[model samples]
Target: MFKYFNPNKVFFITSKAPKYVLILFIIVFTIGLIESLILSPEDYKQSHSVRIMYVHVPAAWITLGIFSTITLFSVFGYIFKNPNFFLISKSLAPSGFIFNIIALVTGSIWGKPTWGTWWAWDARITSMLILALFYGIYLLAWRIYQTQDQAFKVTTIITILGIINIPIIKYSVDWWNTLHQPASINILSKSSIHESMLFPLIIMTAAFALFSLLIFLMKYNTELIKIKNKGLDRL
Candidate 1:
């Protein structure tokens, strides 16, 4: 079972993704945005400001999700000596970094209207800041290293070490008396949010996931092409 889902093989296979996958991603993402932003109802308390959650929460989720993915692939690359794993993981770093920044900005914007402050040293916010910093360092390793192999080694190490923060971000509210709200939509609990609001939020989260996957695949393909062209040049 474990061997059935290898990251190296998965990356290599997706490098040749069919054209339809791209088309489907575009269609689904567009529909998701429409349903989330236009069709959804406004919150009773926050009014239109609640729409920010459609964007903010999804960005936060993707930021952490993508980083965790990169870390897993980085570990696989290190243990299996798989170039594909490293390449895919490296390609994902920029997208994850961008989402992290988006999440932070959107969170701050949302906070101003709700929390009455643009910024706070809350555990969730600070952990996200740290997550973004980790992404920057990971990208810096690629830019600073002279060789691809050296960059991969260093970045993989950094990615693996950065996994420690994933839990911190998730449990930050619990660990500290933070201003951030506790989880209201966990698997264990029936959603504390109203259906009117929850529907849009779910649509937006799905859209964000699709969009991130689309970008990740595109970037992964671009990296593969670069590697191939470099090999050809050497030849």
Candidate 2:
């Protein structure tokens, strides 16, 4: 299906990305850290600890976002029989898993002070845990299947199946009464948060987006290198 296997296009995109994106990411991340940690006002309820939400919330958002992207690629690979699509999906799994873990860890840390417990069997937390488990299974598919094609097929199925959980996680708080807060940016109203808090939150979200893009680009480049070397080995 991928008739346009343009190595020159991929190389140009990958090589040109690092220079501009890296500088932008570093600058944004630094500004975001300062805004969130130093300038933001303390929460009325949780006080300073509420600042952690900047990191925790963004991590959670990115984790889900990455998984959704992977699922899309998996679908594309399955439908079009595209090896490049599968390769990109596989490369993305590691970063998705890492972000999922970060979200879980940071959520637990934030929960302890706010909820009086590190974790609960609440809908939100449980759904996030399920996401992590699916990531593990996706990785395992790669290791267990002997052939790359076989692994890609299996993992693609796994990824597509796991996507069902994304909506559940998103609506978990609303679906069932839970400790987790309801959606902040929604149709009902503007976010309940104040300007001081909102500014940092936006900064941090942008930083996470930039960081995810940077990492994805790097991983994609590595996979291209591996593919090139494999061709050499075959020759």
Worst 10 residues of 1 by lDDT: 1-10
The regions of model 1 sitting more than 4 angstroms off are: 1-19, 232-235
lDDT of 1 by residue, 14-129 (tens): 76663556677677677767777788888778888888888898889889999999999888878887666777788788889999999999999999999999999998899889
lDDT of 2 by residue, 1-235 (tens): 2545454457668867977888998999999999999988899999999988999888888889989989998888788777777767877778778889988999899999998999999899999999999999998998899787788789888987899999999989988999888877654678778888888888898888888888878887887787777774210
Clashing pairs in 1: none
Tell me how candidate 2 scores on lDDT. Answer: 0.85
Best by TM-score: 2
The pairs that clash in candidate 2 are none
Candidate of highest lDDT: 2
RMSD value for candidate 1: 3.1
**Distance from true position, residue 111, model 2, in Å?**
1.0
